[model samples]
Target: MKAKVVALLCFLNLCWLLIGGGVFSALEWQHESAERVSFEDTRSRLLQNYSCLTEEEVTNFIRAIVTATNAGLTLDNSTASDTSNWDFGNSVFFSSTVISTIGYGHISPSTYGGQAFLVPYALIGIPLCGLMLNGIGENIGNFITKKKEQYKKRWSKKVSDRTAEVLVMLILFLLFLVFLVLIPSAIFLALEGWSYHISIYYSFVTLTTIGFGDYVPGQNSAQRVVYRLAILCWFMIGLSWMAVILNQVSTFLTDIGVKAQTAREERKKKKEGDVGEEGEENKAAEDEENWGSTKSAKQSNVELRNMTPIES
Candidate 1:
């Protein structure tokens, strides 16, 4: 029954995935079609206004502009020696995002070499990041489990095992929330001159790996290197903290499921045992009644046999 329930859940999840994918694909197609139409209209207007350029030339020019923009290059800004996107701090930030799979994409590799390096870089870095996060999470989880055990032993009358676990999880969660989310948000607010709410939103978005690309930090700052490094550290620690929380939550849920399943099995066994006992009792009662009837019939026969004279 449990296996069937799990299979059904998996089937439902697959269906949900397919439906979501189809809806998103349709929306993307519509958006791309509209964008293409708008692009063609703009191109025609530009060609009409500037008759010197042919359609093909305008197309090539637009492609060049797009490619340069995506590559983080600025063709118009000849006087600017260095683009902020390619600076040390921003580069580090971009690299961290790539490895972490956050990919906020505010700044990206502009060169073919850089792009080529990024693929292998991420292939190596992502696994390393995963290993680091997992290791940290496991250690923290073990620590909490140990602490809970110690508490159970020390305060046998006061604290239960489940209560100790809950307390540990809550404390860890609060610590992470304050240090990784709240404090960072406050710092970002001061550094980026953003509102407190926006800072908090950005922190949550980045840590959660959503990377919506709506709000980015250190884009226009003079202290680019320091800010980017700080952000990178925040990403690392925040990701690890998130992993810890997830680990605890998963453990808690799994424990609950196991206990519930055990309880259910016990109940089922008890019910079957009750039914078996009741059947045995009924059988025993029937056997006793039959024995008593057979003995009474034999005794009547014996008594008749003893009354020989009156048997006529």
Candidate 2:
């Protein structure tokens, strides 16, 4: 039941990240819009008496052409067409475009409604997403730990120096990284007709979680979520691969053998040291667990104060 609850919460958090990130991401990406335009109401007034063309007349003529074509699109809905500053819909779009790093530069918590919605939304959303990702990442880390042990065991019987095996694996990883990730990304950019630099930037930004929102996939709303999900896959794989690399580095540092007690002790010490550093916080959180049924509340408090911090 607990696992189900946790998983459901995680799934909901992931969905919220997807939706919010999609909208917010779209807004920041607005700055990189491909086209710019200037809309003026004077085009109609100028065109009423003027029919001849001069060197400077070309500017007025072009405005007349645009004015005739747009008719009411610009006049009736001026704010909608206005590109002077970032707009609300654009801001919402900016958030949902990336995983995190939502940039609502144009529409912060300024208005009464904006303040009412944004503050609690952000406070809950950020931690929920963080918790969800970390919970999922723990599973990936466990998988990596197992894979590392398997590799060590496989190499232990025949290989004299584990260094050579690690090097070989690193080489294989590099090859896979290039072929599986980089090449496909290149092909995607080429096929999509996006700039090579922007594509690469998106790929790296997505995997690293830096998500500057300078670039994103699927310009249109219809398939943007799909693009984000594809990018999420990249993040997951990159993280898993990083864990594999970290395990290799750790293996080199710790002697690879049946009896490497010193390495185990060192790792344990590091874990304990980290817990020691968080001693006060941990004790405060778990204070209720320290008590017995018979103890008075005041006495329990005194005992708890005297107790030393320990790790889970």
Record all residue pairs in model 1 with backbone atoms less than 3 Å apart, i.e. clashing: 71-110
Q: Provide the global lDDT of candidate 1 against the true structure.
A: 0.83
What residue runs in model 1 are displaced by over 4 Å at the alpha carbon? 5-69, 72-81, 87-89, 108-116, 146-160, 303-310
lDDT of 2 at 257: 42
Q: Which 10 consecutive positions of candidate 1 have the poorest summed lDDT?
A: 72-81
Error of 1 at 117 (Å): 3.7
Superposed model 2: Cα runs more than 4 Å off: 1-99, 102-112, 158-180, 183-187, 232-312
Write the residue-wise lDDT of candidate 2 on 1-312 in tens digits.
268758987999999999999998898666544333123345444555565545367686688766643332223353435431224444445443323433313223345886687667777766675565566656765665566567767776776446555755576468546854577579557656677766766566655556554554443334445654564555555644544555556656555542466678999999999998799778866775656433687787788888878721
Q: For model 2, what is the alpha-carbon lDDT of residue 218?
A: 42
Instruction: Please report how far candidate 2 places residue 56 from its true position, in Å.
Output: 17
